[model samples]
Target: MSLDLGMTNAPGSTPRAPGRLGVPVSAAEALRYLTDLGMWLDERRKQLDAIDQAALSAPDQSDREALTHDITVSMALWKAISDRYELLRVTFDSGRVGPVQAEQLSTLIWGRLDVAPGDGREATRARMPSGAESNLAVSLPEACRLSDAMSSSLRARLALETTGLDVSIRVKGIRESVERIRDQVSMMPLGATRDRTQRELIALEQRLFDVTERAKRGADVGGFLGPLEVEVAARERDLIVAASRRHESERDAARARELITALAARGDAIRGLQAQCLAAVTPAPKLAVPDVRALGAVPDDPDAIDALLARLGLVGKALDQAHETYARALGERDELQGLLGALDAQVAGSPAVTAAERADLKPMRDQLAAVLAATPVPLVRARALMAAYQSYVRTVTNNGRAPL
Candidate 1:
């Protein structure tokens, strides 16, 4: 099943508001929400289980420690959300909940409540931090939102950032890139081009050997890894470009050319998306997108073509990450703007909101609007303005009343 479970906000979007269980919550609506939360909790439980297994199997102490902490936080949040869900389910399952009961349910849903492991079997096993009981607390929606975010992040790490295998995987990838370049270089006709390429390969091999030795000895070679990968990828591109220029098998060259063309087109699309994201949000992620055109023409050598294909696969992955990062940023900005607009509308239409109160709220609203309307919206400033507006509206309209 897709891991897009729970009440998760998309990459850059704001989280959806939790269903209100205020006075007069409909039985049908409450039941439907409860059922969905139940399903969400079930999926979350599976996620937590998988995360726990990943923690146990983590490559090293640090990996294990980090994953373990994540597991704890996810679990604590899940339990908090789950507890309120149960309370609501039992109250609503019997039939209609009275006003007092509904008010209490609203508190359970929206109020900041204690969120520690209970004194049960599972709690005993958790062994949470000292005084965790007193320190950790969140509302039901907050817990659900946090759990969704943590699960998504931890899922990514488990898939891509398993530190124990990270170095080996990176080294293997670099090694493949190097071999592919070697194939392209070998297809070159004998002379200065071939000889020079051969010498470069030797140098790359030597560096690869040194990197391998350092890794075995447990030295931190991370600083060398990225540069090495880039160098090999660049060499592969140069070799392909050179080979494609040479007269060779028309069939193989055409195949290579087709592949490169497709990749270049993909690269162009990704770059366009990147540009849109940058324009849509301030403080966009700074990423160097891989340009397939840099690899040059499709070589006539079958082996070299295969190697180029492998390199293209790596490029595709890089582009995917870039796309996700930028898309999330854009989504977040749009969601925040939508939320600010929604809040402004809500306050303006509120029954208790007087003309004078609306006048008082106008400045903050306009400031927030200006910020949102700015090119590359300053999300931080917009968010702050939004919070101030919400707080101010509450104070103006319902100063003595308890917040809903």
Candidate 2:
């Protein structure tokens, strides 16, 4: 008798006793059970195809996601059932399908097929079993043959299906690749080829639409997505080249900014110290500093900028030494003489200082006074005398809090 099974309903079917679960008790019965489920799944797939056709224009993102998941899950379930059925058939043909073995196989098949996933449903038709009680969730009895929890007999391989090629996995991979390409297109920076790539993008999108329509109609998806994949790869290559050129241009621009900054710093240094250095020398060379502020015509090459800067003024370690000498000559003579006079007055009036300390400080003060009297005091002597006098003054003052 033909048995009608629902996810949640009276377990027995046809002339079977009431309240008894209608599980197949033999290999032949189990095979029939799986075959019936295969047919049922086909009908569900057809319904999904119809949904795809209906949602062609203005498809909802969430609905498409849901539909994809449903298709994937249903396909997986159908495959599992068909494989188990083939295994049973092979074993039965080989005379290995014993009573206990058949019962175990039947139970495994029922557990998988008799329950629907959470949030999944058949809206157009009512299932005999309500599908509320998931057979997968129910713990099978320990006494059951396949329920051993350890070293289970289900380790055997099922018969493989070789009659037809299954291209579902291929379609899934290509669709995922297309999705990654779509994401990349959005983030790609604008360039000379950007507008052209955008046009190619429109064509790529149309191909994806055609692929979807063909998939719904049960046509070959690989043929449609294959060319689309090639087109996508080409655009990605173009974008990479564009990005490389843009990066080189950006690097040149950044180098130009650095050149401007260097010029400004050198201008500040030259303006402050150039006159003093020239005045110190008997025969000074004529120096012409370019207008650093006007750089609209300057080339971006770093090497060229450095050459221009070097030619315009004194630089390198020699320039640094000159700057140091200029600063010392300009201020040391006057500043040291003023400090010595202040120390002399402090010494004469202080109760903290002795006559001996005053005598020791007098000679250094005289030397600084002699240097200041010279017309253009030699920078080297002034710097040395300035340091010597400063050291003596600090010793006499001793931080200004104790006797000298």
Give all TM-scores, in the order shown: 0.35, 0.32
* Deviating ranges (above 4 Å) for candidate 2: 1-191, 202-206, 209-218, 226-266, 274-338, 346-367, 373-376, 383-404
Which portions of model 1 show Cα errors greater than 4 Å?
1-259, 391-404
Summarize candidate 2's per-residue lDDT along 1-404 as a digit string, tens digits. 11111211111111111112335456555455445544544543343343334333324666544344333333333334345546645555644567666665655543323223322344332221112122222211111111110001000001011113244543443354345445545656666445666676777767777887888898866555545544553344334333333443455456556655776686568656667645553233345444455545444443465454554343333444545655655555556567667766766676755678778878878887777666545656766887777677667666466532
lDDT (10s digit) by residue, model 1, range 237-299 = 345334333422454467667767877787788789889877877777888788988887666
Candidate 1, residue 201: Cα displacement in angstroms equals 36
In model 1, the number of clashes is 2
Q: Which of the numbered candidates is closest to the native, going by highest TM-score?
A: 1
Local distance difference test, candidate 2: 0.45
Superposed by TM-score, candidate 1 places the C-alpha of residue 141 at a distance from the truth, in angstroms, of: 65
The 10-residue segment of model 2 with minimum total lDDT is: 149-158
